[model samples]
Target chain A: MTSLLALGILLLTAFLLLVVALLTRNSTPRFREIPALTRLVRTLGLSVEDGKRLHISLGHGSLLDERGGSAFAGLAALRIITEKTSVSDMPSVASAGDPALGLLTQDTMQAGYQAAGVEELYVPTTSRVTGLTPFSYAAGAMHIASNENVSTNIMIGHFGPEAGLLADISDRDYVTLIGASDNLAGQSVLYASTQDALIGEELFATGAYLGAGTSHSASLTVQDILRWLIIITLLGGAAAKFVGVI
Target chain B: MRVLTAVIAIAVGLMVLLGYFFAEFVGIQTLLLNWAVILAGVASLVGIFNLIAVHTDKVRRAEKGGVYSALLVIALVATFVFGLILQPQHQIMQVLLNGIILPVEATLMGLLTITLLYAAIRLLRRRADVMSVFFIITAVLIFLGSATLPTGDVPVIGTLIRPWVSQIWALGGARGILIGVALGTLVTGLRVLFGIDRPYGGK
Candidate 1:
């Protein structure tokens, strides 16, 4: 079992390296002076708009945060947002529940805007610590998802059942909500939305999705290949064990 | 160099993964896991220090809502005292965490359900769309299915609905979502692998 699991890990690592190599061959994310999201909002929406809003929810973090990799996903997601949405001068609203997460998220969002050269759009009040409760967090997110003016709500991180309600509410309001939750129920909400679900490690794969940077995306891709390899290896091992092939 | 960190990380991950079924490898994995826990406990002090610094500075500046900072301090100290003063194995800390924090968190979470219900009911009300209505039906049915399974009054009905929704969701919707999420993760990881993103630098 250990060998199989390790084999999965090895396979994932190799795949990640491959993805990294492939992406590096292409251009990485470049922050535009004006957010491209503005075009989407201005041309797509009614008359005038405050531009699109990118909502990023950093998960509760992992049992092992030695390097803070879990929270790193949220921060990386913000980076990609900064690169794309602000190319034509748009805004993004971010909020968090965990204080530590709140602090980190604030920095990342601000950094995102700075990278895009539109730090002016970063809202201080919007990046508040929603609540100490899942419900309160849900309540706060629902407000963002359903409110007018905000175009795209990229909901990511550690979410629960209320997350489904929040994601569904975005579609209800004709707003686009890219929901990514780590939990099973939260994942189910993704399926309920106009888009498909982004669950588990996908929550941390934001950087790759938006073409933000390379390393994180590479690691994520590698994990996927590794996952499948692990699955196949299991069958191989089962056969071996059954026939005493070792 | 990034290579060193990447290599070590992959090595550790592989060892841990291998340790899953291999008893011999389990020893090293357990040790590494313990090291991880110890690291977490140690790094938590950074958070504690940050809290202290932020609140202390707020109290010193006497800023608006600084009193709330004081309250936070009070809460932290009170909780810590109760935790350390009581027997190490006692439920005192657990009581505080569960009794006080849990209820507040749970109530707040429960409140979202109302909003969720509203969002579900109002999904198609204000929109000029059919997909919104489709979403509404799916949301309502899923909600009802979930809400009903908990009552436990009708064992037969509960038994039927539980697996029904579970499989429908797991095999149907969940599987699809998993694929997207998987693809997204793969892409993101690839970007990272190529140094397209440097998350380690606090960006």
Candidate 2:
């Protein structure tokens, strides 16, 4: 019974996202996340004269694998951060494990910063290519986190169990922390977030809210509806199950 | 011919993807899974060949770790023979690996944690800000909550935190983070599957 409910929710969520993605693809890409993040940026200290560094990692997925697309989300997040950070004269640093992702992440950040009218805020060296091993990559990230003196760390992409280790260590040690990752372990780290903002679906909402492109905004609107439908169905199912209804 | 390759790929792809939802289609699903396993097993030989080629080149060049490579060969041969000759549950082989090798990795990880802890402490010394305060408070809370030690014996402290700690640490903060992460993951997955933002060279 529980299995059936879970499957139902999964299918419904997928369906909703599919519809929304299709509808909004050509209109505007940045949807829900832009305003919130822009407000967050305005709320932050741009007057301090240096833009905060942003770190975005596309998890352990291989760029070489034909199936790999985890890093793409990181590229997307880079665009928003780039635009916002640049306009405010706040610097953003983005990094990737795959060399391919490294190229894309830097390009996107540069584009966003250029849009924001603060091209200097985009530092190319910040988007690094590291060793392929998950732990080795994590170690490289840890080093960069310490060295760069970044104000916000944003992670968006696929992650594994090792992600928790980095999140825990980063939060425990550094004063600069803005974490966003799809890794299950990231939740534990994010839950502990105090000074920095750890966004949820808000990252997906970015493309639409910012009006970056059509497909992006549409996806967010669909995701919002889908998320609520899931909650309602699950709640209804639970209630029915308690009353002994199938 | 190219079209045939593409056709086969899409057909097999749908089966692999859809199999997750329709486990009731047992026969077809099992055949695909079994074939995947077999292919993976065959591919393991490729990795072994690569390892040998690299190590042989290292040994021939008398690289810095060439002796370590030589020792690895000796250990690999011995362990393979011992493993095949002896049952897995046999005492000696288990003892050597479990007793020695396991501890080494564990100790190294433990050492890394300790050094990491020290670095965090030092960072706190340098910059005493909002982010630092949040991180320290949360780490201590989680660590203390998970610890099963003689701390419960302490009258004022353990009793005070025991019940509420779970609510404060585990339920409140943990649940929020979990929901955020789940949402992020779901969005990411949708983005990939739909090719809205293709990182992979898309068709």
Interface root-mean-square deviation, each candidate: 5.9, 8.3
Model 2 Cα lDDT, one tens digit per residue, A109-212:
66676666766665555455543446645655655465555555556665544454556556665544445554435433343432343445554454444344
TM-score of each: 0.61, 0.54
Q: What is the lDDT of residue A176 in candidate 1?
A: 61
lDDT at residue A193 of model 2 (Cα atoms): 36
Count of backbone collisions in candidate 1: 43
DockQ of 1: 0.20
Name the top DockQ candidate.
1
Model 2 Cα RMSD, 1 decimal: 9.3
| Residue A50 accuracy (lDDT) in model 2 | 59
State the C-alpha lDDT per candidate. Answer: 0.57, 0.55
